[model samples]
Target: MSSGSNSARRVASLLRPSIIDSGVCRSCQETIGRRSYATATPAATESTTTPPVVTPAYTINAGVVLSRPPQITRELEPFEKAFFFYQKRLNERLALPFTKYFYFKRGTPADEDWKKKIQERRTAARDIGKYNAYDSDAWNDELLLGAEQSEPANQVEALVQDAESTANATSQDTSKKEDIPRPYPRITEADQKNDQKSLNRLLSRTLYLLVQSKEGNWKFPTSPVETGETLRLAAERTLSESAGVNMNTWMVGYHPVGWHKFNAPRAKKGETAKPDASGSKVFFLKSRIMAGQADLSINTQNLKDFKWLAKEELPQYLNTQYYSNIKNMLADR
Candidate 1:
């Protein structure tokens, strides 16, 4: 054997068994006169595992300013007042053929806005293949809430102008008495007829409560239930953020009236879904405004419009089953 290899063999033979058992090897310990510092090293791959996602202790949506909770006063209980109002309205509904009575102001700018709204609704109905209201062509003074008339249609205006022209001419060439204009009501008569038709079309669909979202989609204000919060509490948060300017005026039913379950579509190739395969579930509690006026200033700051809609009226705006739930909440049946 070579001299170096011969020396290595001699040193290995002289090594004590105790030295090896103490985690020291001949090449690293005896040769260096001491053990080298060492530790168990994890594999390279073990260092690169994905970290867990951390959720916040309290959850809330972005840009949402939490409002103060409602104050219960020494006054009447909310449920009692609501029940009384409900009973009164219900009695009025049963007493008349028309379940609801609407009063409109006359000769105001609001009248024009109403007219525009009616026209818009009619156009939408036509597009959707739905019929307008009953007696849409009616022009009687009683049917118009005392406004009594509308801007006459072009055809009616043309006829009126022709009648006036006939009245202007001497009665020699045209002796037809029916075509003559004498103390007859002007364009308003024709306008009223057209307006009645428009109003009928508008009335075909019931008024629905809707809030226009930032994306321009119409939906109710909704939010996630926070930790340590009840469904009613979460619902109150949502309401105060969206519709109730005075958070103190809002009230909620203790139990959930309905729920909406949402699941995201399956991921496409090379894509991964969110951590939770089941997306989310939203429970809706029955709610009411206690004393404040309906305000569009709070939750609607970024929105265009919001309205308080009756249950049956939501069919024009919401999914069928959702509409049914709302209907059940609002009516006897």
Candidate 2:
């Protein structure tokens, strides 16, 4: 062949794709076709490779939202009180008349007593707003009964007397027995004295446990999560160790309720910082105390004081940031 024609054939071979051998199977040719895309270019290779991202290490801790649920119903708002009062009146109007004879046989002491009481009360079933007027005559106290000649001059005073008299009689005849049990007052001595440590205080609101550290920082009971320990188990251990074993408590669930994270404290002067210290992460688990109280006297965490405070009171004791972070997990009432 001529030198120019030989050079032209070499250039054509360089531009064309390689052909599969005629002897090769269809499958082998298909495999070879796929291998063509694997040819690497500088831009393609650089685009495909990625440097692994490194996440900073954190010291994991578990905390407990140890709380005492409300022992009594929360105080009703004015609107709520009116709503309940309306409901009670509506229910009373809808109810069938009480058949006293059916309950107590005729001519017996019970029947006689019922009749006497009914006569004394003289309150109609349809009486909605009016207080029991005749109920006041039953009381022996002359001072409460007022003078025989004198009468209440003001309409408000008369209504007040009627209401008081009705309440006294109704309270006495609430049940068949005279020895009906009365509930203890919601306000206890601990509440009056503002004793934060006492469980008896704040009976109508959920109370949380917060402890003051030796450094004067107040927070929920927390401890480092040990190797192979779950957040729940760590929280349980933290409560028992830091708050003492005197409390009777149960974890709400296995899963963590909430979490808080913060940057690690900067190393002090002359102190070598830890290589692995990046930040701190705390996972909180909820718990409820059924009985007993926290005794910090035997705790190993060097806690100075503890308080069982309601959610509204937390802002005064805890850091603003910390309170804001965990406030969603607390009971508002």
Candidate 3:
């Protein structure tokens, strides 16, 4: 052995066993004059995650707004009559004047006949109390100062008598009379008797179908929504079930017109509330009854009665809050 190798062996034999027995490797630990040791490191921890929240479910219902559209025009009020008359006159003034020559040639037999008819027709202003002193005969009454025996007065009286006689003779002859078709009466026997169920009652105004449940509550036909059915489909089915399939009806649209939320029924004293008694929501769809009437006998919901009523008459039959919610959906006439 060389002298250097003998010195290295002497230093290793002098080191303590405690320094060599340390957990850290020899490369990690420093070889200071006083033996040094490595410190232990802590292990990493895993992160925790939070779960998602769930929403509560609500019961959905579909309802129908079955209505009978007005067949005849609604009666006009006196004010409305005057307003329409004024508007008609204003429109007439703005309209292009009729060209007489285009329809009837000048000085022909047809033109002569037209001129005679025009002379016999009285001005509309005479009936409505409208007159222009500068344009028309402002004094509608006959001349009071003129002698009754005047030749012109006698001629006018004769002409008037001849026209009256001809009109009277035509009216008296039954076989020569024109066969003019008259309209069905606005008021029916059902209307006279106040029969609520009859569809023929109100001819002029719009009529809504209101069904009375076995509990005596009046409402539009409605039913719970079934799985796999849309709101519109549910509404269609509900109407057929509640009002019967006899009526020919058409839904207005696929979307709902309005929605009303109903609260869960309150439990009585000493009674437990049902678990699935969550409040329901009703979405209404507008529909029109084109033909046939509601037959309550075949109603699956056990509806006791029904009515075809006008919008104005609904308040008398339905509750205030319920009526107010649906008032806008109903037609005025």
Best by TM-score: 2
Tens-place lDDT per residue, model 1, 57-84, is 3333211111122222223344554454
Q: Global lDDT of each model?
A: 0.46, 0.75, 0.73
* Full ranking by lDDT: 2, 3, 1
Which residue pairs in candidate 2 have backbone atoms (N, alpha carbon, C) closer than 3 angstroms, thus clashing?
none
Q: For candidate 3, lDDT tens digit of each residue in 248-279?
A: 99999999888777787879999997766677
Candidate 1 structure, TM-score to reference: 0.35
Question: Where's the lowest-lDDT run of ten residues in candidate 1?
Answer: 139-148
Question: In order, how many clashes per candidate?
Answer: 3, 0, 0
lDDT of 2: 0.75
Across 1-333, the per-residue lDDT of candidate 2 in tens digits comes to 899999988885565434555766777767766764435655644467687765567889999999999888876554554455455445654464655567899899998897676556434343323432223432221222232212212323444444555666767566553333334666899999999999999999999999999999999999899999888889989999899998789999998888888787789999998766688888899999988989888998999999999998999999988988899999898
* TM-score pick, better of 1 and 2: 2
Q: Which regions of candidate 1 fall more than 4 Å away from where they truly are? A: 1-208, 246-252, 268-270, 276-278, 300-302, 320-327
TM-score of each: 0.35, 0.61, 0.59
The alpha-carbon lDDT assigned to residue 285 of candidate 1 equals 61
Candidates 1 and 2, the one with greater lDDT: 2
